[model samples]
Target: MSEDVLVVHGGTPLRGEIQVRGAKNLVSKAMVAAVLGETASTLYDVPAIRDVEIVTGLLEAHGVKVSTGPEGELVMDPANVTRAAVDEINVHAGSSRIPILFCGPLLHRLGHAFIPDLGGCKIGDRPIDFHIQALREFGAVVDKRPDGLHLSAPNGLRGIKYELEYPSVGSTEQVLLTAVLADGVTELRNAAVEPEIVDLICVLQKMGAIIKVHTDRVIEIQGVAKLSGYSHRPIPDRIEAASWGAAALATHGEIFVRGAKQADMMTFLNVYRSVGGAFSVDDSPIGGGIRFWHPGGELQPVALETDVHPGLMTDWQQPLVVALTQARGLSIVHETVYERRFGYTTELRQMGANIQLYSECLGGTPCRWGRRNFLHSAVIAGPSKLHAADLQIPDLRAGFSHLIAALAAEGTSRVYGVDRYISRGYEDFDGKLAALGARTERP
Candidate 1:
């Protein structure tokens, strides 16, 4: 695919409803789960993202019959999984972090697997150490080859107790996939408790897997001899919802986000309200959703921080920073989860935001990663003028932030790399922009 660009005319109030599709996180995992079943599994409401395509390519390489349904749904049959070719792995290796999720099912069915390097956000050094170690705990012998990682479970997987030092989503997903088919029960402590994990667990349970979630960040999985194909809709993308909410706040506009769940966005909604953003939820609407708006009031600046699940997500930091730029006073943002998250703020700086990076937190809250010599703090002195300029999107949330910058800017702005992968999560983002009255067109 060639690089695509977005030309956006600025200073327009976004006013309309945008429907969010299936969660990108869930659909990818559902594709991974399809690898375990012999029959065809159909996944509906799947977004056409590059990462999703990459995962589908990986599945096809592993000898699965993958096809698109008439309704834009995804169909997968893993009956001939033994036809997995190592050379075909190159096409999808290093495409996404999701490909590594195949380790568990592949090991269970074939007893050996080869995983290429993983690719995703570049916010920090997202090492797969936790994943490798967790797989080892499940009796998988892992070896780092010059090409990629080689894994084998000669004796078959046996349940073992493993505790993670940090609750990483990818690491937690690796453990869950590997543990489900072990010979005995496997217990994972300090597991990531994100909504995506919850969805994955539910999908696994639908396939006859025995899994239980506890309040203490623990997950117990009982080894199942086999799992059937599943068909389910994944959770709505909360991160995407937060991005649209940030766009509404930054432009001081009103927008209704359909399919945005209140339960999934509790942390972001609370922060939105704290920042003087107004929102209302329709519990019994035709389908149920929420509307977020600025309501022509003074936006409040907040001292915020990012954390793992149940905390301010690091992915939301970049887009929310755009809203913080429109706040009345100083807004201090501490990015504790990813050290390099503040890199996108540099782009926002060029758009006329008064944001300064700091090596330490001004507040007394000592962050575990911040104290270790990372430039983990940002101070936004806002109510500043933003001007449109040529911008390039480096990542997902940063892409949304640039979009907000374009909307808040005074003139036309050109954004490159937009078509690279933005639709993976946004789902007809350009159409949403048009509905909102933003002069958005592709070039």
Candidate 2:
């Protein structure tokens, strides 16, 4: 098997157990958080994903000592942390948005930081304006140039009260990373309260940082003078677990996702059950995970709206849409999070799925993209016969969705660009697929 393209033989249900490690979202951020520590920090359950490799390169460029310990463990030493050149940083940050997150930690450690051109998934207009604005609020000077953005704390960072127009997770993380070592108190209004955010707070607290989470999406951080290292086990990737579960449902198979936590998947579980998927949780001493399966009946259609935490996740919507294609009736998916996420559905349609994109909101929710004329909503007419095709992966989550469609299709499928995008999040994807009885090989 080569490393670029996956030739998947379809019409087989994926049945087996696959282990999931730390979340791609939290693990990268945690690695970044290690920069704020004065000593060394050890993170357990780290996944071997592209994002982690990118962050490790960026951190090492800044003189942080990153080494591997036991399996699924990363030890990061930031005691020798120093500023890295813009070109040096840019070369290592290829197609990753993680460089934008290094701003606050760099400013605190070296009083200045330079961010190269940021790149990430082409799912939406993910601007750095929010990050820059928050940095300015914390008294950091930002100079925009053609090369990149230069930031410096001329008078040192000072905490200030700030509120976001929307509860953006990246912006909120920027605030936390900066405010933890600021001069005074920082209060954030309309903050993102995702479980990953909470886990970050836990990591910060372990490093002697004081933070408070209040009701109604409020977070207060009291600035501290110094911080130690942290030893933490990050939360598992719920998105990957749910994606595998959706794959099982789409192909009419059963899968046991070890290390999947039930508490973190409540919203997805509810939606999965509503779509006629059955899941059982195991809390025994032997192993703990969720078992998901299709119950050999007509899958029900569901009306789903993607929102922030405690709501339907935008990441989960893509893989679930593949399962929705096998349902009996029409399924409505309102993607309120990212406007351009529906672009991947076009590829699914090529595989014989009946999906229609709409500019108007269709799930009866008043969303921010309602009148924006973006294809933010989709109506999927299900039970469409899916067939094999040469598929191109667009982004990470969408790439996984395409893989699910390929596995559930009728013939052989040639899926390209899996290594480029899907490896950014999913670890050992082809190996895991092969373990789950998938007939796939690299072409």
Candidate 3:
């Protein structure tokens, strides 16, 4: 509640070092993976974010005892996993999409699961059809009630060869979690091979799940009868790292992001360099991180499209767009991952950005959204001197981008709903901003 509003005095460069812990994308799923284990599991570098708190509460609702082990450690003991009361489940999971992931692990431990209506960032049509269909294929009976979704595995779970229509991260995680404990072998094609997903697979493997990854988009999992605990240190938050990188570029400052991995961010790094942002990768064991800065020149503009793994991630698009606003020429951005991801551009435009959205695919490749009449492509003509305006935080990533835009703008900006939206992913962002010398205060 204290983070509900922030008043940011703009037109200042952000300079300093910030550390990003475990990824927001992987940490929650790793905690949920603990539910599939019989004994206790330990996850290191768990971020102090709202999403982790939500998952901790949800796990507690289902009787998984969650506690801190050491510094930055989350210990989850599923020794007493059981079915939680409906109200209890709803209370912990009402505002998160994490509950949908609880389905697979819950069905394996208990016979059933009661999932409350899920909510997350309203980025686009994030459908659960792939999840539901995968569950049904694995022998779970799904009942859609007015209260929420009720799922039961009457015949027990059995593996199936499933192919994803699209390589969705959530859907792939759902399948992996379910298939790990099913009766037989499960082959998933066109799976999302994001670093977070791979890290999740590593967690499951440590817990005795047999998983094989192919060069192509195929993942084969051999379901086991039982699984024990695991100890894992999740991958660094690449999304958060890229965000800070964009922040540095947009504000014409330098930032050293500790724990940012270069291998995980090769695509983003290439694009960052293309935008005329300078970076140095330091992989030394003691002082390892990527240093990002605007190397005292006009920011370059280039065409970019968001795609699956090994492509420009959709999550990386928003913050980078803020940096693109200062580019010397036209920057074309085609968002193919989510149809409604450009929703935040309207807010950016209000802050004096010259961004225009189009329905056609403006990049090199034509995407699914090309003919769907979705305003998924953007043309930003920059070197546009930005001036601040009152803005509302739209979603998790967009909220951070809004802050970046505010820092780059001329006047003061009143960014509202930070507590409600931004805190869901970012951990102690105000503290990080203060460390970087950006002037902000709660209003």
Candidate 4:
């Protein structure tokens, strides 16, 4: 049996309760932030995902002593943070996009950094132009190399005013990690205020950085001469939480997601309600969770769009789209965030989903992808009866969506490359599926 493949006996509703810890999006970046600190930093409730492992390995490569606590607690010491060992080595052979984020902090501390080509989920064209420009604005010298990117702060990093064409979360993170220790103040406009980004800012603040979030998506960071480590518990995984919520809907099951927060999931909650999926929030300090269920009725479809933050998140779009296949009427999804997000819809169509992709923007909001000749929008006509088939997992979000489709479809589905993609984000996913009574096995 190969670990890359999975056998999913579909028609099993994912029931029972599963707990999510700190967000995958946050925990990995927070680990990178520890390299920016002078002393050791402690983070609690970290998930055991492959991304975290990659980040831990990258940190160790830079001489950061990372240790674990009883649970998912990690303590990182950057006292011996070193210049990257090899100028040409690609960390994790480029399995992560996070390596690009290290350019800022590494330049600030070691005066230079060598980042190999970065790799992440192939959802769309996520370029690093804004990130490079922002770094250049901070007075860092960048040289493009065959192996990867080489960055050096010959004149040292300084604060600068920068604006993004889009509210890109990665660029915002690059700026935050660099600006916090630069000279003078940094004002960023049209920034990404995603909950994960805000939480990352808080982590930096705990490490003795001063940051202010003002009106109109503006974030100001006052550069400090020095910063110590921080002790923090990151926000729970909202993306994963929403995935389960959508899973419950797709399979007509009920699932209680522990550590799911209400405040962070307002937009998703509203959409869940709009789709006729029922959810109740329990905001207890301990053992709190969101109970999501099908509520024994036909799932309603609605027009949906993906945006940066405070909008329907792009990550949640795929899984929920699976649920929408079972909904009454048609569902319009305008993917404003990623130009090629509808790629997974093809697999869904193969599973008997009545979906059509469009190059035109399906909604009133014309996104950057419109008129770019990309089929970024989708119209799903349902409730379509889905049957299992041989499937291949593409990227992370789409992989999870494929898994959800397989779980919700009739008969069984053979899904390949689950170990590579799904484990990168979802921790203990197979175990969790088993606990949820899903018959998933490695074949």
lDDT on C-alpha atoms for all candidate structures: 0.84, 0.93, 0.93, 0.91
The regions of model 3 sitting more than 4 angstroms off are 1-3
Over the full model, what C-alpha lDDT does candidate 4 score relative to the true structure?
A: 0.91
Candidate 4: residue pairs that collide: none
lDDT, candidate 2, 1-443, per-residue tens: 25779999999999999999999999999999999999999999899999999999999999999999787889999989998977789896557998988899999999999988888899999798999999999999998898888999999999999999999999999999999999999999999999999999999999999999999999999999999999999998999999999999999999999999999999999999999999999976447899999989899999999999989888999999999999999999999988899889888999999999999988877898888899998999989999999998989999999999999999999999899999999999988999999999876
Q: lDDT per residue, candidate 3, 55-79, as tens digits?
A: 9999999999999966689999999
Instruction: Please report the TM-score between candidate 3 and the true structure.
Output: 0.99
lDDT of 1 by residue, 314-388 (tens): 888888899988899999998877777788888889989999988887555777665677778999997889999
Task: Estimate the TM-score of every prediction.
Answer: 0.96, 0.99, 0.99, 0.98
Q: How many clashing pairs per prediction, in order?
A: 0, 0, 0, 0
Identify the superior model by lDDT, candidate 1 or candidate 4. 4
Better of 1 and 2 by TM-score: 2
Cα shift from native, residue 161, model 2 (Å) = 0.5
- Model 2 ranges off by over 4 Å: none
Model 4 per-residue lDDT tens digits across residues 62-105: 88999998789999999998866664246475699888888888
Worst 10 residues of 3 by lDDT: 87-96
Displacement of residue 4 (Cα, Å) in model 4 is: 1.1
